[model samples]
Target chain A: MKKIIYLDNAATTEIHPDVLNEMLPFFKKMYGNPSSIYSLAKSSKRGINLARERVAKALNASTKEIYFTSGGTESDNWAIKGIAFANEKKGKHIITSCIEHHAVLHTCEYLTKYGFEITYLPVSEKGIIDVKELERAIRKDTTLVSIMFANNEIGTIQPIKEIGEIAKKNNIYFHTDAVQAIGNVSIDVEKLNIDLLSLSAHKINGPKGIGALYIREGVNISSMIHGGMQEFGRRAGTENVAGIIGLGKAIELSTNDITRKTGYLKELRDYTIDEIVKRIPDTIVNGDRVKRLANNINICFKYIEGESILLMLDHEGICASSGSACTSGSLEPSHVLLAIGLPHEIAHGSLRLTLSKNNSKEEIDYVIERLTAIVKNLRELSPLNK
Target chain B: MEEYSKEVIEHFLNPRNVGEIKDADGVGEVGNPVCGDIMRMYIKVKKDIITDVKFLTFGCGAAVATSSMVTEMIKGKSLEKAEEITNINVAEALGGLPPIKMHCSNLAQQCVKAAILDYRKKHEK
Candidate 1:
């Protein structure tokens, strides 16, 4: 097998060895349920509590406010649906940006059927939303506002602080899907004035099935799941003890070491961006250079299609994703790219390279070399090529 | 990145006969940017034989590979023989594309048929 250079960290990260080690004990000796009253279950309960504390501490929120769920999608659904259903009679209006993940946007769309009005906030060509526009979109009937902290596709980080402030001043609840931003950036829920924030473990080099939703204390949230008394009866499922321990370890390590990790990723990301621009003509970077995530590089090579670029890269053992889901079941390009006013051809050709702290300079250089050749070859093959 | 044959990957990376044919007798363009796959074909014909074929395709790896393969198959063949060039033969020629890409794979054959039809409409007079 060829050596692999994994740059598609946005899809998911490999579980950290430390996180995996912390979780190993739970599956064997500490297998008792946290909900059970037996003495054997105390270790599992302690593991869950420690994880809750770690997640809460990472966001500067109280332990009581952290609620665990399946993953980013579940947390997003719970936050949007929880607020919408809870305040249905007060006001059916909900506002979310058009560039959000399907988790948030789809949830808002689902609410539209329940007589809940949804307003999709548009982003600029650089994928930034104006604070004033968000303020104007707020209405008396608006129950909640959900905008992602950073986009998964373009890596555009929205003005979450401003949006949160606007939501607060209007007395509306604000939820942010920070699935892509949480580990890479330092986030304080109180500082950002966020009412609800979602983060997934796998995105931060932890286990896949566990995630947390930060609901500010005293925020009204209707439960998405019923029956079991777990998660304060908010998300009723048997606790994923091993996954929780892994998430806790992962969050604690990532946040404890975030400054260095992010800085390193940023250096590599900028270098690659510069190298690609210098080597390839007619290529344009997609998102705001400075405002974008430190680990993300979305660049569009003119005339060539994204899937072809990805395929050539794969043949070289370099893995990345087209920001567009074009090759998949959805023929349409990425909504995030389209929302940013990219034409269909440009959007269709967008390639996203999300980095990880583990990526070395050598790997980055090899990727650039292979990628430059691939782009040139594809462009030559493209009819629209210059 | 499903398991594509070496031939498909080969043509995708190094496709043959790219670009447009200036003042070509017949032209066919198929697919939309929305669908994320588009193939434009230009053919030069003489005495009922396709003298030369060229194509410009903007699509996934399979689309480009299929387009290249179809052009190679029907380049010197007569219009009637070229009309029989199916996407299946293109796929088989390239050792098969991923099943999901089979839909966009047909864009090459469709464009070929359209171009031949275009030639017929123009020369029947």
Candidate 2:
């Protein structure tokens, strides 16, 4: 039997015990449709409303501002397309960064097909987009500016507050996809002046298939899903009662533990970075060192392919993700790595190791011990070993 | 969880003929850095026969497996016989590869042909 040490927390997280415990009754004894016309439905509706209030409280927003959706992807799609279509008469221009999740990028691209103009803001070598460059890119016809609060691949934390201030000065709506940053960092929607925000439960040790989109009060945005009057007719679907309960519990727990967990993760991340760079030669760490997420450690090894390293890591029962396209079905290097000025070959050698509160120093040491040997073995068999 | 075939994992665990032949008669290197698969093949030819072959590959399990299998398939065979090996043949020889990983076998096959071409160019007297 292999001792599994999972580190791909950015992709998804193991559900917390408290979250699972909260959701079981909804799946078994308390099974009732939130939209039903019976007293049995009271608990279901109460559960969803509690989840919404919890999500809203996490972002310092009003309860009415939080609307539950399927997940981050759906929220992102709705925010971009909903705002673009709703404000088409005002302007058809949108703004985003080059390192957004595909939910945002693809939605922007989808709108471009329908005659919507978008300007993708470029980033620095450390993966931080320039505020002045953003201000310059904004035109009178720009309707919205959507930027990620923290990047998923490189883990760069953009200046969302400053970007929001710029948008407010121009009276453009500001939306941020904070899926990766929600539990790992502190966020105050009121302080940041964020108009719209997207978050997923699974990223914070909650159940999957449930998320929330925070819309500021009185924002006249159009709806994307239009079947039932669920989600206040914004997104059309019967509410996921079990998943919502899980999310609320998960959010409550993670918010309380954020300070201690993030502090520990940052220490571990920095230690890992220091050790890898010191022990391994020709390594480049991606993302801004100070402004990056506490749990993300993205590094590139020269002359070694990431898929080979990942395969070898799997043999050692270590789970991580690679930016290389060979393992994934994509045919190009990670766009985030490339956007940060990495050469194509260097980008192919990148690895992302995201952590969680469950991780320990012993696990980190075990990874370091195995990774050193694995990199040596792969580099020996690599064609780039010149 | 286990996306790789048993044969692919076996070959990757213990790759054969992995090294560069210093002062080799012919060498071929091919890869697209964007896709992160690279192959370097070295061959020793005599009397139009491939007396020895070696491959160094930087890629996934499929790439390492295909390289090992391709080298084992072509050693001591005539250059003409070795040139007939294709990506499909290498994949079939190792049970099979996922559709996305077919390019790994393609890299092996292309490297063999490329090494032969390099051998022919140098000997065109």
Candidate 3:
């Protein structure tokens, strides 16, 4: 088998060895239910509590405020729909950005059909939502304001602190789908004035199928999923013991090594972007260069389809993704790219190469070399190319 | 990643005949802006036989590969026979496309038929 270099970290990450190690015992010897009262259950409860503490500490929140769920999508649904239904009496108005993940966007769309008015805040050409526009869009009955901490497609980091401040001033519950931002950047719920925060374990190298939502103390949220008395009855399902342990361990590792990793990834990401622009003419980077994720590089090759570039890159043993993996099978441009004012042709040409800690400078260089060759070849066949 | 069949990967990695022929005898473009994929096909037809065929696509790997394969499959065939190309045939030619990518091949076949109609329209005049 040929050696493949994986660079689509924004979509997901390889689980850290430390996290896997932490989760091992729970799968076998410590497989007791945390809800049970026996000695075996006591150890399971202890593990759950410790993991909760680590996760809460990472976000600067109380452990009691964190409710574990399936993953980002579930957490997002719980935060958006839960709040929408719970606070329907207050005001049926909700405001979210146009570039939110499908989880948030679709949830908001669902709410719209249920008599909940929704205003999609537009982002600037840089992909950051206009704060003043958000302020103006707030209504007396605005029950919730949900936006992503960072965009999954373009990697643009929004001004969550500012948005949170506005939501607080208006007495609206502020929620952010922080799936892409949790480990890549510092997130303090109190500092950012975040009311409800959604996180996914997989994005931070924990496990798949496990995530958590940080609900500020005193926030009103109805249960989206109901079953047995698990997660303090906030979410009702038997706890995923191993996944929670892995998530806790992963969060701990991410928070501890974030500074060093951020620096390294930023250096590597910027280097790759710079080389791509210099080596390939008419290439443009999507999203704000400075405020974007440290490891995400989205570029448009002016006259070529991103899928073609990805295919060539795959043949060369490089793994990455287009702007929207869900829409990759279709020929339409990415909604995020189109929202940012890219022409349809250029938008179709978008390619995203998101990195991980495991990716080295040598790997980055190899990708750059392969990508340059691929772009040049694709452009050679492009009718729009001069 | 699912192990893409050797033929599919070959078409995807090195798509054949992927450029537009300037001043071609017929040209056809299809796809809506909402669908996110668009294909423009060009053909040089002589006495109802396609002497050369090429395409320009703005879409994913499946779309590009499908268009490339379409051009290759129809280049030496008569216009009437080229119209027989179907989405399934294009997909099967590449071993098999993911179910979701089937539309890409559909778009390619549509482009071929539309281009043939364009050729017929020109010749009848």
Candidate 4:
């Protein structure tokens, strides 16, 4: 059996052992509904409360402000449509960026049909939204501004604090999808003046199907899901006990080792980028170098498609992702790449290799070796190379 | 990752006949830039039989491997028989693709049919 080198951490990280350990009790021994009023349920409620507090402290918010959801998409939908529908009488205007995850973009699109006007701010070639442009786009009727803290594809970290301040000045509700940023970077909701925030556990080496939204106290956002009194009636579903437990443990572990692990990933990421660019010609790194995620490296080879590159890498036992996994089967280039000003040809050739603590320098070197050979071979056959 | 069949991994690791044929009898290209895959196929037909076939593909490993295998399968076969090659046949040639990567084999089959159509169009004219 060939040993596989897994590098596609951006899609989802392997669940940490500690997180799994923390969740095991909930799945078997401590199986009690938090909503139930019994001694067993008390412990479950306590676990949920403790997890909420840990998450809140991580974001510098109150535990009462946090409401759990399935994942980033659910949190995003609740924040956008929930706010838009609740405040429709006040204003029907919303603002977001072109590079936002489809969760936010598609929700906004749905709102547009209901008479809400959306202003999608454009990013520069490096995939950073202009704060000045955002300020100029804001009108008196603009009720909400939802921007992602970090882009999933390009890994560009936005100026969320500055954007939050602008939203504050304009007295608009600010929501940031921090699914990719939560464990990777420091986030102080109060410091950033963020009104609402979204996060997912899968991005931080936790189990999937568990996430949370931090809505500031007194925010007028309505619930998208209706059911029995759950999540303070804000998000209605039986609490995901095992998933939430794993998420809490994952966040705790991530926050504890964030500084050291981030430094390690940054070193490995830079080394990989340096090696790739040194060996390959006409390759451009996507996203801003300085203001990007520590784990993400998105690059576009001038004349080769990313799918081909990934396929060849797979054969070499190295795993990675193209710009958009959703469009991998289709022949179309990534919309995020197109939005960041890549030409259609270059966009099709984008590869995103995200790192994690599990990745090592030796693995990165092996990847570079295989990638170089594959690119050279594929480019030789590409008519566009000439 | 699941254990891939030996043939699938073989084609992926050592894809055969990958590249374009210059001045070919017929050419066919599929997949758009936005779609994240592009395959260009060239055919050299002699007396209504495909004497040689080659493919240049910019896609995932399965796509490149499928194209390579498709060309190898069609070479020396009559145009009518080559045109009958289906996605199932191409996938089976590799012992089977992942469910997600099956589309790549489908793309390869489409390219073959298209190339045959192009040959028929030119020869009839």
Tell me, by DockQ, which candidate is best: 2
Poorest 10 consecutive residues by lDDT, candidate 2 chain A: A324-333
Residue-wise lDDT of candidate 2 within A3-80, one digit each (tens)? Answer: 899989999999999899989999997788999989899989998889888887888999889988889999999899
Tell me which residue pairs clash in candidate 3. Answer: A331-B36, A331-B37, A332-B36, A332-B37
TM-score of chain A of 4: 0.98
The iRMS of the candidates, in order, is: 2.1, 1.8, 3.7, 3.4
Question: For candidate 3, lDDT tens digit of each residue in A1-386?
Answer: 99989999998899889899889999989989999999999888888899899999999999999999999999999999999999999999999988888899889999888999999988899999999999999888999999899999889999999998998888999999999998889999999999999999998888999999999999999998889988888899889989998889989888887889899999998999999999989988889999999989998887777767777887788888885332443445677888898877677777898998889999988888888888888777655664
Model 1: colliding residue pairs: none
Candidate 1 CA-lDDT value: 0.89
Give the range of the ten consecutive residues with the poorest summed lDDT in model 2 chain B.
B29-38
Write candidate 4's Cα lDDT for A161-266 as tens digits: 8999999999999999999998889999999999999999999999999999999999999899999888998888899988888888888888886789899989
Would you list the rank order by TM-score, best first? 2, 1, 3, 4
Candidate No. with top lDDT: 2
DockQ, Cα level, model 2 = 0.70
Per-chain TM-score, chain A, candidate 1:
0.98
- Per-candidate TM equals 0.94, 0.98, 0.93, 0.90
In candidate 3, which residue ranges exceed 4 Å CA deviation?
A324-331, B1-5, B18-48, B114-125
Candidate 1 chain A lDDT trough over 10 residues, lowest sum: A323-332
